[model samples]
Target: MQRTFLQPDDVRDLVTDQFGGGRRPIALDRLTGGSKKGVYRLRLDDHSTAILYVWSAGENYWPPSLTVPDDPFTDASGAELFAVSHAALVAAGVGTPQVLALVRGSRYFDADVALVEDAGVDTLEAVMERDPGAAVGPLSALGDGLRRLHTTVGAEYGKLAAVARGEASQRRRVEDVIVDRALGQLRGAAAHDGRIAEAHDRIAGHVRHLRGAVAERRAYGLIHGELGPDHVLVSPAGEPLIIDIEGLAYFDVEWEHAWLQLRFGDAYPMLRPVDLDPHRLRLYRYAQVLSLIEGPLRIADTDFPERQWMLDLAERNIAKALAAV
Candidate 1:
């Protein structure tokens, strides 16, 4: 995969082509913090600002070589889905960035880009990191926003594309989908370190036991998939606008709640009363750990700084899951 960077002028031209002429960009600042995409804050001549999101061809996953045969969406399709999901969330009264235009399969650059209304400077992660005490308001707002998001339900549970095409009925149950993917990831990891095979089988048995429970209690809805503090931007007035809608999918609302608990349970205890299923939450936690394990293990030879940390997290979470059993 070839790397590509869009200059300020190129972005200005793209925006002008979409929104019309006479809009001049005063400053283009590359923003850091996202793992999957490059973001830039473009300050316009009218004192307004917009966000430019760019995603390279094969950089969606770590190691840049891992591929899933069952996954139907490409980078271009993902950008389009992001726009559609953002629109749906906004229409549902959820705080989200307003997408202006999406440039897919552009010849000028080897990446897909989306121009959107600037959400804010402070992500919920930054707010919580800077002041955990004051984070209650934003976190509560985030919880409320997620509740609103879950109200948008789908006919079936699976990928967004499959749902859109009315093919979600043919897809496997969300629990089985996750379990199969986790097992595949574990098998891939075991190719490098055979020690993971036993743990994989053990976790598989635990996951299988929870499948019946998941089948009985799951609700299909629009899930943010990864709603950690990082994807939420808190406006100055304390409104929480969700960004990075790429992971939007038709899945169990409990999955979203579970991820929230797994990521921020200790820092914020207010979510304990949100009525999440304990068994499903545990299953999702195991799935999250397996996901964390797969990426780093696939690229262990690289200079990726987080490789060891991810492996350690997976190991620790594996131990915790085992002890809970």
Candidate 2:
């Protein structure tokens, strides 16, 4: 099927109708780095802006064959996921861009659309790059949000949308679920990359061994599964607001920290994280590299333009995953 993109007029009518204003959107520009859905900035005639999320098959760059339906970690897309995730975060007192309206069916087009308030600021990643000193406040804010978010625990462990709809399967162990998904990615990655293929046994064994080392836990902390600097926005008042939040769920706080440590690098100390399980962190860090290796290779095979970046990501992580063994 041919992939389609959205135009300003495609959303303007919906925007005006939902927002109930004479001021229509003057421009709807597509934002980059959105692989799973169409992310657009809807600039209004009044100089205000909102974000539009369109979940459609055409908008996604990921191959359907790559994702497993049973994997809790896979494909946290769609309007329901976004809405539930937004609500979950808000309930925890964690800041996310406020969702303005939702269009469930294709009232305007052949996709689920959500209009959300724009973060209206540079991403924490960009801010950290342009001026490291400027990043201190935002990082502090983000760290605070994470601390609060992790305090809110849940009985079940999985994506909020799935959990809300009773779609999450009852499992004996959360680490088991994590181990299963990581194994799938690494095995698939081994098929394509000679490095992972050669070290497949050792890498797979390493992951399984790490899983065995993890202890059974009772409490599950809420987490932004993909909490990278790029996923955070720093508002003008120095508050950090999380975006691309469809993957929000209750899980090990250590899992969130592992990603934060990898993405935040030297600045991770700003978060002042405490009392984490090292065993889980080690397991998650190494296993998530497998996901990094496979996900890029999968998407790179599609019509995604950033093929080289994807390959480079997979290539670099190949060494990381191999070294973990």
Candidate 3:
């Protein structure tokens, strides 16, 4: 069944309250690709625009049973998570949409709503495809921003929100947590795809081998758990502004480079990523591939517009993961 999304009328009062009656909402259209929250482009009568992020039970696709709210690697959604991640990114000098107004327990809807500046509609992926050199400046800026983000670490490794609240972490080492996530993702992928199921044992064995090869580390870097090119917006001024930042965590930077390698592909070199441990990168590559395979397959079950793309991504990563083993 299709659900009704918020319209201009639904948030007309909100726009009036925030931007005043002179800037009432003229149009409200939902943007594609945000599975955890409702991303809508709100246009005002004067033609100015803002992005609305709504966190409600109706918007989120993940079930409550599957979420580990405090875990660094679990379903990291909700208004609190977004606020915390946004604060962390802002403090680290990362580019993001400026927060306009934060409405909690809104009268329009029983949810949290955030009004933010519009960072343009074109993502880094589209900009990169428009021309080979289109993404170079943005990617270089992203490299500099990521350096500041990664170097901004904490005493305990976990979601930035938990760390902010002085929560104690159960995992002793980042490597151990990564290996556990890999094993979990391996099982999830095997259950979803027959080809992955066939080589499950072999892949599991290789994961165990890689686990042992990783050395102990005392520190980890902050990371945007999912940094796909699509998640990055290329502003008109040729800047890379990060979106969907609810997954900021203090973890191994190699986990980040592994994602950059997978998502950025041929364009990875433009970012000029630095100081990644080869051993962590190797293990993280397998873990990242398994995660990529499992994630797309899982999200494909939702009412996402790019359903076929998700399945294709899963298939490609499955091939990559199987070959690596």
Candidate 4:
């Protein structure tokens, strides 16, 4: 299938078709989130707002190197998963962004999916930009949301066994591609830099550590997979509304802790307004960083400090992962 990208007009048409009122979107604006997915906010005739999330079925987005199946993950499958998981998180009482509607396959060769709804508070990255010293109340709410997500849906593990299996299986496949490519690249590159090799070794060790945690019957519920400050949105009431589960997956109960550490452990001192379990949070951050090392080398431009920061963070994660082992 040919790769197709949606335009503003195409998005408007999709909205009209989905709503079936011939009501076109008054304004179509691009959303700032997920690098792989295209999010849009549409204004309807009823003065209401909706969010559209377009998911593409391609290796270019996830990386051909990562362990993902060659088969395209169906849009319906994605819609079902997103609706269920997002709703379940909310039902579990997590303050996540509400999913007004999910529109798929309306554009771009059954690709270019979208989620439409009213916008949540500005992203954490935006908030931090305005008020760097803002209270941890928002961040705390985010942590709580993650905890809720993990604790809830314990039963889904059995149902999502296929998902877990696919993920684990693909983990190796994608890793193999990445390793081979990286090794080849490293070999051909100028003077040998130990960073790439060290990164590979350290990240591998971190994942191995996580495997042990899961094997020990410490399986936590579904993790956000990509739980970062930016992925979370703060509501006007100061509640954190977790958004963007593009990386949702199941893992050890403590993987969330590890993730939190890898991403925000460095900023622990700054999170003073809201009181939280500091020790556990740090662990989450550490594991979080470790997990990220093995993830796609690319980070969305929407993420602050740009791709450079992501690579830098990945490097940092590799070091931490090595230290842990």
Candidate with the greatest TM-score versus the true structure: 2
Best-to-worst order by TM-score is 2, 3, 1, 4
- RMSD list, candidates in order: 3.4, 1.6, 1.9, 6.8
Better of 1 and 4 by TM-score: 1
Cα-based TM-score, every candidate = 0.83, 0.95, 0.94, 0.66
Instruction: Give the range of the ten consecutive residues with the poorest summed lDDT in model 4.
Output: 67-76
lDDT of 3 by residue, 168-230 (tens): 484577777777777777888787899999999999999989988888886878899879899
Worst 10 residues of 2 by lDDT: 64-73
Using lDDT as the measure, the top candidate is: 2
As a whole number from 0 to 100, the lDDT of residue 111 in candidate 1 is 72
Kindly list the per-residue Cα lDDT of model 4 for residues 228-256, writing each as its tens digit: 67777777777777776544545444445
Models sorted by lDDT, best on top: 2, 3, 1, 4
Cα lDDT computed for each candidate against the true fold: 0.68, 0.85, 0.84, 0.51
Q: What does the lDDT come to for candidate 3?
A: 0.84
